[model samples]
Structures are given as structure tokens and as C-alpha cells.
Target: MSDEIGLILCPEARYNRSPIVLVENKLGVESWCVKFLLPYVHNKLLLYRQRKQWLDREALVDITCTLLLLNSDFTTAWNVRKELLQCGALNPERDLYLGKLALTKFPKSPETWIHRRWVLQQVLRECSPPSLDRKEQADSDLRDSAEKTRLSERLHRVLHDEMKVCADAAGRYPSNYNAWSHRIWVLQNMAQGNLKVLHDELSSMREWVSMHVSDHSGFHYRQFLLKALVRELSQSLHHHHAPWPSPGTSSPCSPSPDPQPAHHQANREATAAAPCPSPATPEDQSSVPAMPQLFHQEMELCTDLIQSFPGHETLWCHRRHVFYLWHHWRRDHNHHDGQGCGSESPQLNHTDAGLSSHPHTASPRGVGLDRVESRNGQAQEGQNAMEVDGVGIPDPCDTKRLKRGPPDPCPPALPSEHGFVASVLDGCLSPEQGCFALAYRKWLDSVIGQ
Candidate 1:
């Protein structure tokens, strides 16, 4: 029995019989056995299977976690861990730590990412609602509000940590769809209602996009955040005015308060007539940057990035979404102000001013204007000399010049958002640009024409 135990434990005996050596080289055999084939793993697997059969939550959690650290793709093990989490035997934070460990080894594994999202969801569920109930004597509204605030703060911290982790994974693998999708899910679920939190998230994401311009996932997430921010701003505006009932008679059952003072009525009318530039209360003021300003800021950021990475299809796609949103906002603003969609609004003017003022200081087409001008001049002189030589054949250079026909004129600055987008897209429409660029340009034209 002692001799048999020695043979079983010997490296040569194990290497000869183990299928792990068939798949992995000698360099990994020792490490692999230490991590996955030690007596502890075999015992834990047996114990986990026993616990699973008996539905023992605590032991299952311990066993699943140990197995998961060694092999994150073990779907059954993750499912058992999920069961443990649901039954309250495993802490969500501990699950999160296990997820982090698993992800470090299996960043691209869909199972690991799905488990991470589940852990986050469980944490959120625990932090919210009936689980966070107040004592019986507590004032319901105040206690509920405080609990909600605390919940939001806790979720904000957790989601931000998750975002950092996702960003790190994405940096490691620029096209990691799982990482990007998980981050978007976190933002969509967790970052609503709080403008400061959204703004901070947007600021951080701007840095991330700048660093990872070629990654479409980051840009797509930015589009989601931008759209959400716009929606939040619109909702805030509605909320700010919801308390002030429109001027009209009240219900006969309840007497109305005294009519607004003339000065206050005038101020209200002024605010309603001109939607922009209304002063927010001190508490709400910080959250009230004009939507057009935000959109233009994003446009400039996109322009700078597109210039830096001209071939990046993701940046161009993101810009198209931004333009689409801006167009709708501009149209809505015009409708509210009793102006035709064709008429220039202040917001449109602001966008135009930004677009016109920031002339493409560098040639976008990778050819300098001066070089083109010089070539055209030389071509013209050659054509004149050929004409003097009485050669009737068109100079090839002249034919090329005619085909090119000097760069299109800088588009007339327009005050509509669609017009601005059209002009910017036109500038980007070099013959050498990608199919997406040309296709998007045509789509923009169709949208604008409609």
C-alpha cells in the first residue's frame, strides 16, 4: 500500500497517466496539478457534489467558490453558487470577490461575466425595498426616503467599482464585448435619477473613450449615457414646473389658493415663453446645464476624436447617433417656441457658432490645402504649355484636375442641427473615407431632406 501511494504521487507516474499533460506542456504540469489536481480539489469536488445533492447552502458555497477560482467555466458550480446567494447563505460581497478572482483568469468567459452581473443584481436587490425596511415606529416617508438615498449611494459606489473593473478588462482586451456589455448594463440600471452621479460617470467614460477610440463598445455606451442624460434633463424640467398648476379654475370641492401676484405671473409667462435661461433653485441649479451646451460639448469631443482616429468606424457611428438626438431636440425646441423647424433657434445658433468657429485646423483628408493648390497650379501651367505645343489631346493631369475639381467649398454655416451635422459630414467625406462614412453621409442627407 505504501509503494502504491508513492507511485500514485510520483510526478512521472502522474504525468504518464494524466490527460492534463496531453493537453498542456511539461511547463504547466506542476502548476496545473498544484492548482487543479491536488487532493484538496478532489475532496472539495466530492464534498460539493454531496452538498449539492443534499442542498447544503454553506458547504456548496465554499465548494463552488473553490472550484470557480480553479475553473470559472464550470457552469454547474456557478449555478450552485447562485443558489447559495439566493438563499442568503453566501454574502454578495464575497461572491463579488470570487467573481473578481474568476474574471482575472477568464476575462472573456460569458459564464463568469453572467455570474458577476448576478452578484451585482443580488446586491442591488438586497440594498433596495422591503429588505431595507425601517422600524415600525419610524415615519414612513422620511424613513423610506432616507433608505432610498442610502441605497442609491451604495449602488453608486458598487457600480463605479464595477465600471473600473470593466474598464481594466477592456483595456486588457480592447474588443471585450462582455466587459462592455456588462458595464452598459450596470449604467442603465444603476445610474438613473441622479444627475451628479451620471455626470461623474460621463466624465470618467470620456477619458475611457479617449484612451480606447477604436473600441465601438465604449462609444456605444457613451451614446446610451448621453441619451439617458438628455432624458433626465427633460424630466427635471417637467418636475420643476409640475408644482405650479397651469392658470385655470379649480375644483369646486376645494378652494384654490389666491391667484399669483401680477409680477409672479409675468415671470411665469416669461419663463414659459422662452424655455431656455430659466434660473433653477439653488439645489437644482448645478444639474441644469443647457442641453444644447452639453450636446455641443460632446460634438466637439467627437470631432477631436474623429480627427485623431479617422478610420475608426465606432466614432463615426457614435457621432451619427449624437446628430440624430440633436436634430430631434432642435425640432422639439422649435415647436415649443412657436417657430418653424426651418427657423433658427438660439440653441441651433449656439451649435452653428461652435461648428463654424472650430474650423478643421488640419486637413481631414490627409492632404494639405497648400499641396493641392500647388499641384493644381503646376497642372494648369502644363496644360497651357501643351496648348502652345498644339497637342489636341487633353493632358492627363488636366483630366485628373477636372475630375477632382478643387475641394468642395466650405459648406455655408447653417443654424439647424441637421444642417450642422450635414456640413460636418460633408467635410469628412473624402474619397478615401470608408464605406460607413459615405453610407452615413447619404443617410444624413435623407434624414435632413425628410
Candidate 2:
């Protein structure tokens, strides 16, 4: 690669080599450039660059496949990806190598779309090219066309099967951007008249997204579901005299239940004197916005999750989307607050220990610097005292010199509070007071509550 590209293919070309120079006491900007740019380079080159040349095609295929799976830049991977496709090794029956590569690269490059189109085009071009007239030549051409068609059909079948696997895997890991985008690309290029499969695919994806509403990736997937559903619904509603009821409305044609309260619970709790529908229980509720009305329901569920598990960073991050939407609504309304929402703010009050609020500990010093620093200093003092007694006084020459004089004074112990103040001033902790001091009353109540 270096011979072809005009640089050392191995060590000199290895990305992130600058620190190596600093550590090994070597010189040059070439090493520094290599170190700084390793993250952007393809893993194929990164791995082989550490070794001598004469690499195997399979080695490049495996390395490129892993890079595609992990999602290195599309353009960088693009250069090596052709090797995987040509190696005749990344079979759909064995693994979803090309499918995953296509999926991961879709967001950043036209190359993914190009690659898929190429798969189809090459298959067709090889199998069914135009004929030239000659009795022997025409017969040979016909046979060649037949072989190409057969091969193309086989590859297309692999393409479809691998895409299904990719979609299923994406459903399992909804947070994966590459997986989700790839699923979309697969659906887009599916055989034109397979509406039944397309509809079923959309339905399955919706169910998966609904099952994991707390996941931001799932929420994003729901937007994709809505887009697919709208198109389908629009086609179905074309003959209607009235405008279609907002999505998932009760209709004989639609499979979904009416946007009803969990009526099953209502029936379970039936009584002659109290006949209203029972409220949604946490278990019976769908966390996802199954219908348009359910979007607000999902938002409320996210808010409830925050209140229920305030210490969870994941839940807090999930709740931010609701905050963002509310903020947008407020902005549209001349800065008026949204209903049931407080002032639009992004503030999140997390403690230094990553807790949303200070947890009550029974110790005199709360979850703050006092105890941490005190313990640190006591251990340090013990070590220092041992050093002074063991080494300072034991040196015979120093002892003889000091024997005629008073013993040397030991160094003054450093104040623990000063260190605490310094750490706080450095923006690592609360500057106003120690953790215990900042909310003393709350800490006391928490202790009592526990």
C-alpha cells in the first residue's frame, strides 16, 4: 500500500504514531501525523501497517468486514470494501457482512446505494448482455447470458435474505444508528410489488420499536414507522368520502384497537356502582406512542420514569427529548409555558457522585470533600510519619550532625479544608459549600426518612 500510495506502508504509515516518537525519543512530523489520524484510517490498513507486506485477500476481507461492522468512515471503508465483495468469502449464508456494511455506511455515503445498485446491475449485465450474430458465437453468447442470469438471481436472493437478518438484528439493538438506517435502505429497494412484505415489515418494525420506547433509538424508529404507515394509510384512505381519522383510528380495515384506555383493566375491576374505565396500570400501558394520541402518553411515561429513577443517566437523557419538544412548543407560542410543564429549561441537577440528588449517608460529613479528604490525609500522614521515623532519624551521619543540636522540626501537616477548597475552586465540586453543607436540612430529612 505504501509503495502504491507513496508512504511507508507499515510502521511509518501507522496512524497515531506521534506518542510512540515522544516515548521512544525519536523525531519527525510524519510520526505525529500518523498518530493523529489513526482513528480516521481504515482498520484494514491500520492492522497490516503494523506488519510486513504480502497480505492475504481473506485477511483484508476479514479486516474490512470488521471495520464495516464497527462503522469506520464510509469513504475510507469504501476503498477496501470492494475487496470483501470480490473475495467470494463474505457469503450471506455465513454472515451479514455486506448487509451490515451497506447499513452502516448509508448515513454518510452514496456508495452504499451505489454498491447495492451495482450488485443488481452486475448480476444483470453479466447474465443478459446484448447478442451478436454468428451461429457458433450466438449460441455461446446465449449460454453465457443464461449463466449470468442464474448467478444474478442467486445473488439477489442472498441480498434479500441478508437484509431481513440485518433488520431483525437492528430491532434487537434499536440504539444502533447503522442498523436502523440499513433497515430503511433495505426496505426502500425491496422488490417493487411486494406490498404485502413491505406492510408486514413495517408492522414488525413498529412492534419492535414499541417494545423499547425508553430507548432513543426506538423513538427514532417510531418516526420511520409513522412515515411508512402514513403512506400505506394514504393509499387506503383514497376512496374515503371523509378525511382519514388520525392514525390508528378504529376501523374494520385496521388491525389496531381503538385508542381506548386499557379496557381490560376496567373489566377486571368491574363493579355495578363504579362503571368507568379503569386507569392504565404501569404493566398494561404501552410505553410507545402507538397512535398519534399516544405520543403524549409516551412523553408522560418518560417523565414518570425520570421521577421514578432520578439517578439513572439513561432515563434523564431520554427525558431531554420531551424537554426539547416542550421548549419548541413554548417558542412557537411567544414564550408561553406548555400545559403541565414548568419553565422551559435544560437544567439537570445531578450530584458530583452522578446521583440526581445527594443520597443520605449517616456519616457526619455528607457525600462531600470533608470525609474524602480527611481519609486521604490520614493515610498520607501515616505514610509520611513512617518515612520520617524510619529514614530521617536513622541516617548515622545526619544523626551525628544533629546529635549535638536539638532534633529537627517535622513539616507542618497540611489543612484538609484548604485542599477541599482548591478542588472546588478548580470546578470539580461545589464552590459554595461542602456537599453536606449545601443542603444540610435535606440530608437530615433523608436520614430520618430512611
Candidate 3:
């Protein structure tokens, strides 16, 4: 038996088999057995030698289990994992053990991530909901999501906190597809509240991606941020444009306290500009008028967004819509000669006197009158050159320009065209040109004699 054990532990043998059998039975311990067994069993033997009485039969059981796991005997490995967790080992490695076993043994394992979430889920399902019932008690120890009302709020916080962890982990292993996929999963889960949290998260994610802008991950991150912004902006636009009851209408459907803005002066101007569609009666003296300035405020928000994110073409398109609506609105009430720069006719205000008194410095036939400051604080021609002919004059509004021209030589080309004019037509192209397409077109037409 001793010779047999020595043969099994021989250096040339390479037997990773369990050595517990020889060590368990009163082994005539062999040289081969000692060769393979010394490294692992050395510590256990030292403990046993120091305390001989503690080294009874059951002690060998622990040794056998250790050997099985080290040898990759999976059944014994799983048993060890269960025992470790049962003994309250809550290390992250212990959780990793659970994950590994679940992957290998179950293969189609649902338990890996589920168990990880279970720790957080247990807090809400148990501690959180029950705390609400005892809230009336003076000394209740209610905390976290223990109250029903706080459950949704707490769940959101937990998810966001985990997302930060996952994002950090992804930063360490930036090429990790799994980490990024998990982030997208979390955002999709949080999309229940019109995706408000998701939008906020993506906005933050963009800041992180900025440092790694050249990476492919950054490109994908950009797509996510843009998509989320598009959704959020669309939702906000819908809310801003939603129909609401006019103030002083006593109907129960009327919004409480009347939610309109406090720009009474602006509202009065809008009312004077366009007759209110709502009916008025002497009994409802408190009825405030409709405000076109609300539309202006909305357009201003869209315009600021376009300026802030110059690459966002959709915002520019929306701003164009707002401008068009403002134009139509002014024209509808025969207020075409309004206060804006493109007014059809000027108002005879006090400023007109000042304007008429000043010398009119006109440009030469093709040269623009570039301005210079006169000693008297007036505008004067700084230069004179025939080449400046049609330059520096802001183009007239699109409708006015179209009226002056023969019907656009051909219907405007599709937005996809890459030519100078086509780029202006497409909002996705140059916004400077798109917003000023009329001026650009006029210059091009003049230069080309088209």
C-alpha cells in the first residue's frame, strides 16, 4: 500500500487525483504521494501536528473537500461554495463564486445577476414597505425605502447608484461590451417616467465620453445621448403646446389658479395683435387674454438650445417652424408692419426724426457701405470699392424674396443634395446657411447670373 501511494505521487505521474484516500486511510505514505500532496496539505498537517487531539476523523473531511475543489472536481466545488455562503461570507468574491457555479452548473443560469439584485430588492420588499405601517409611532426606526411611498424613489436611487459603479467599471475596462450593455439596460428600465431620469443620465454620460471622444465607445455613447435628447425635447414640446383652458372659465376642467406666465404686458400686446378665439362676457371680467409671447418664449428656448448644441439640426428646424408661425401670426391680424426688423412699413415714432436728420451714406453701385464711426458719433462709410456691390445687405425674408423672383427656377432640390444651395436647404447641413439660405441663394444667383 505504501509503495502504491508513492507511485501515485511520483513526479513523472502528474496525477491531479484526490490525495485524500491515502491520507484518509492510515497510509503507508509513499514518496509520490508526498510530492503531489505536500504543497496543499502542508498547512493542514502543521495545524494537526501542533494540536494532535483536534485532528480526529472529521478533520480529514475538510481536507478532502479542499482537495476536490483544487482538483476542479465541480460537485465538491459547489458544495464548498454553498457552505461558505451559508457561513455568512458576504465578500464580493463569494458572490462571484455563486455566479461561477450558476454559470457552469446551470448553464442557462438566471440566478447570477438575479442574486446580485436580490440584496437590493430584499431591502425594498421587506424593510421598506413595512416601515410605513409604524410611521405613526413616535420612535419608529423607519429609514431608506421602508415606506411604500418611498419605494419607487428608493429603487431609482439604487439603480442610479449601481449605474455609477458599472460606469466606473467600464472605464477601467473600456472595451468591455458587457459593461456598456448593462448601462443601456439600466436606462431602458428607468424609461418609465417619460425617461426623465434616463435623459439626465445620458446628459451626464456625455461628459464622461468627452474624454474618450476618439474611441468607438464614445461614438456609440453619442448616439445614445442624441436619441435621448430627441425624445425628451419632443415630449417637452408636446407639453408646451398642449391645449389649456382660458383663464376665468369657471368650468371644472379649467386648470387650478390659471397656469399661464405673468407677462401681462406681453399678453396685452398679443391680444391687441390677434383677437382671442375665446368668448368674453361682462360676468367674467377676470378673464385674461391669450398671449402670443408664450410662443416667443417657446421659440427662444428652442433657439438657445440650437445655439448651445450647434450640431443639433432638429432644433434649428424647430426654430424655423417657430419663426414661420410668428410671421403668419403677425400677418393674420394685418400687423405686417410690426416692430420686427422686416416690418413692411415703418412706424412714425420719435426715432424717425433722428433717423431722417442723419446723412444717408449709401454704398456705390456694387459696393456695400461698410460702417465707420464719425467724430459726431454717427455711422459713415469707411471704405469705397465697386467689388462690395451686393455684400453685407441682409437678405429679405424668404416669402418677400420669392415674390420678387420668377418662381424658383426649379422647385427646391431635396435636402440630401450636397451642392451649396442644397446644403442650405437641408437643416442637417450648415445652419448658418440654412437659417440664412435666402441671402446665400441671392448672392449665388447674382454671382452666377442664374
Candidate achieving the largest lDDT: 1
Candidate 2 accuracy as TM-score: 0.32
* Backbone atom clashes (below 3 Å) for every candidate: 0, 5, 7
- Candidate 1 wrong stretches, greater than 4 Å: 1-31, 34-59, 131-153, 239-288, 339-437
Better of 1 and 3 by lDDT: 1
Candidate 3: tens digits of C-alpha lDDT, residues 140-250: 555432543454555555566556645654565554454455455444433332334544554565556445433455335434544443333333432343232111111
**Candidate number achieving the greatest TM-score relative to the actual structure:** 1
Lowest-lDDT window of 10 residues in candidate 3? 363-372
**lDDT of each candidate versus the true structure:** 0.58, 0.40, 0.37
Q: TM-score rank, highest first?
A: 1, 2, 3
Q: Residues 1-450, candidate 2, lDDT per residue (tens digit)?
A: 000011122444545433322223222234334444545435446656566554576776665644543443455455555545556644423333354333532333345444554453333333333455788676687577565556546545654664565555555444666555555544443322233444455445545544554556655554544444433333333333222122111221222211323532342232212111122233322222222233343444544553443333444344344334332322232122222233332211222232322223222122233445676788667656757545733435445867767622211111211222233334424333333222322432243212
Please give each candidate's TM-score. 0.60, 0.32, 0.31
Name the candidate, 2 or 3, with the larger TM-score value.
2
What lDDT tens digits, residue by residue, belong to model 1 across residues 1-450? Answer: 000000113333333455233222211233435444545754766665676545356666777765665667878888877777777788887777677656665677789899888787677556645523456436576676576667656665677678777876777676788988887666555543456656666777888899888888778878877776776666555344322111111111111222444644553443232112112344653554556557767877886887666667788778778878766754454444343223333333332333343334323211123445676898677667767457665767556858986643221112233343445567665543445566665665466324
Residue 198, candidate 1: C-alpha displacement in angstroms: 1.6
lDDT of model 3 at residue 22?
54
Candidate 2 has an lDDT of 0.40
- Considering summed lDDT, which 10 consecutive residues are worst modelled in model 2? 409-418
